[model samples]
Target chain A: MSKNIIIASTSTLHGGDYLEYLLPELSVHFEHCKTILFIPFARPGGVSHDEYTVKVSSALAKINIEVKGIHEYENFSKAIKNAEGIFTGGGNTFLLVNQLYENNIMTILAEAIKDGIPYLGTSAGSNICGLTMQTTNDMPIIYPPSFETLGLIPFNLNPHYLDSDTQSKHMGETRETRINEFHSFNNIPVVGLREGSWLVVKGDTITLKGHLTARLFRQNQTPAEIESETDLSFLK
Target chain B: MSKNIIIASTSTLHGGDYLEYLLPELSVHFEHCKTILFIPFARPGGVSHDEYTVKVSSALAKINIEVKGIHEYENFSKAIKNAEGIFTGGGNTFLLVNQLYENNIMTILAEAIKDGIPYLGTSAGSNICGLTMQTTNDMPIIYPPSFETLGLIPFNLNPHYLDSDTQSKHMGETRETRINEFHSFNNIPVVGLREGSWLVVKGDTITLKGHLTARLFRQNQTPAEIESETDLSFLK
Candidate 1:
């Protein structure tokens, strides 16, 4: 079986409903699976696990998919092992990675994904699909055990990546400057997935999908803007 | 001896020369000291140690103070111990804390500050004067061995803190939201120091300085705006 994944920059774009923009793709992506094991550890807006899980359930119900939060299961590792399809929602990346390690389910999830169970990740979820969580834009609210993350993709992912507004006078480091600083200490490539963009991964092939282009950062090279439908397998 | 420290929100304000706005305060802060040891480990924008040191040197020269980069010394710990004053410049907080741990100089520097060596810190540097680097706004470009920092101040500091710009359409989390999330996981109070604002620590008294009002976030309490000259020693 080939791995099938949708790594999205965000769960919802500005002025869009929760997970509403990706319902069509998700419907087809999880067509063969009836139920999705939802990992709500990210918990955006400081929502409880149960509440976040219900949000996911409501969104997926439109496509006739049943959803269950991993927290609802007796064993999280077992839940991952038994899941036919999985979806990890967006929130704080540090919190998500910390819980994954604390619950000791990282290995199980990686193994299940390697075995080709369909997977969907958005924002913080998409960030964990990379080599490490070092490139995340989220605040360091908590100290995770490690910055290491699932290496489903050869490189790291920078979600909700926005270009600098030239007209603005914000003195904080721009997204490009931050990524370049990451490259100074890390050699891994980073794909800056702008809002409304995602990557579709099937087997050994990965294609960029969405209306916008992504910015790619390589060590010592100028960042390139990749258009929609571009084959990104070469990055692997 | 009483501790004399300046925890500034930024090294440079918008449209200002490096450390230009704070030069008058810094000159008085280091009145009796002829030379100050500089820690440039935070290396903003991927600048080299010597290069960053040079930038600091040029900025301090306006106040007629000599600056020495910590990297130039043979014994980093001993150099910090013998320094009359210490200054940690702003940059990536993760890199700053990582180097402080790797060099095993966190304790030495913390002790020096406690014993009244006259310390000055801006941005990432100021964030480390707190209990941990959890409130920093920098991206996680690297993972430090620990989030623990010098507990010179009893609470955490969020430097370069900006309030929500309602006119903008950006969908990212606000600084207050991030700090609230931090409080959800940890009970420490956070001081959101806006650019141009700083805290002047003399002995056990910490007074909010500069023109702007600082935002204070305590666990389970509404955030309050503190005016200039407001004594924050109670938070200790």
Candidate 2:
């Protein structure tokens, strides 16, 4: 249970610098690492691998850490196994999971994470840490081999989770309604991680962090708000 | 190419009754039918098959058109072939498409639509009429056998499409950004059917119906707002 991970709801907050809010925390998370492998498969706005990697590099530059895109490697599995640390940026979950499966590195990355390599994930990146990517907010731009994921956590993570706007006139399904529908067919617990909030996984303990509270959804129960500093290890 | 269909952005408007706005049109579209087969695979808010079917039945009762759930039939393919008309209710795109492929009836339904059987699709249902469900906004509650849909139209559809609220502080990916990501990998055109707007397909001519404008998105081209009654045959 030596899972050292940071599952964030978003990579960049609105009006904030890229990864600026989490730099201090990440600085400590990756203290022992020199370079971290970045998986840019989620392709934020369909950015190219190199371009997305550059974004990550720029964000991590302030922390004095180097970043490399996995797509640049000739052997992806070797890259995962040999990486000092790993950082998966967010975009479309389907595309990210598709590339992970297509390159046959899903299991390798999962093993690496389980082996206690520091990991940082935001949005779609954090989604794969759950049992499956079934709770993602991204469009299904690509079909993954399966909905299965790393299963680093027992429950599913719904990143970029937002509460229904009471004044909105939109008829589209709200985030809560969508998750309830997921519960109709699934028995897994779901953590609705709000933007700026994240889960800090250290060994067998997972503590909710940042400035906001998270919504926890379970089958046949009213969703409850979990405050910061809450230990969610019980969900495991 | 006598694809007689009504692809709606939503089954119900923000404050309108279920299918109330579309009843007159549906009355004409399903004029020759006594009973229309209803596929309730997209269970909105985790509604039961029977419960969702009842909602559709109630909505169509005014038109004197009886509605039957496809799940009630012993053979789904036979049910599709025997249907005088078909209506796929919107819920979850992934769930609906999953059931379609799982029951091995995607081809059957596609054939029925191609043969010009009167058809009605709202939201997730309308999403399946496109080249793929890559542009869907529904959470991926389940994984379908393929993202390939019925291909009833030349382009994809984004139902319940909305514009970004300028005053809102939400940082989630906007509909435009999601579609742009889809275009980065796919060259297909996408129609963002806003609430209250629908497409009336007759033969090779697809006319925008209802009172609102539908936004059309093509790769490398600026997205344009198409007024009601505009013939979108050029997209084909």
* TM-scores for every predicted model: 0.98, 0.98
Residue B150, model 2, lDDT: 93
- Model 1 CA deviation exceeding 4 Å by range: none
Best by TM-score: 1
Candidate 1 local lDDT, residue A103 = 97
Ten contiguous residues with the weakest lDDT in model 2 chain A: A136-145
Docking class of 2: high
For each candidate, report what fraction of the true interface contacts it reproduces: 0.60, 0.84
Q: Where does candidate 2 stray beyond 4 Å?
A: none
The candidate maximizing DockQ is 2
lDDT scores in order: 0.92, 0.93
User: Tens-digit lDDT track for model 1 on A1-236?
Assistant: 87899999988877877899999999999999999999999877688999999999988999999999999998999899989899999889999999999999887898899789999999999999999998988888888899999888899999989899788655677889989999889899999999899999998888999999999999999999999999888995
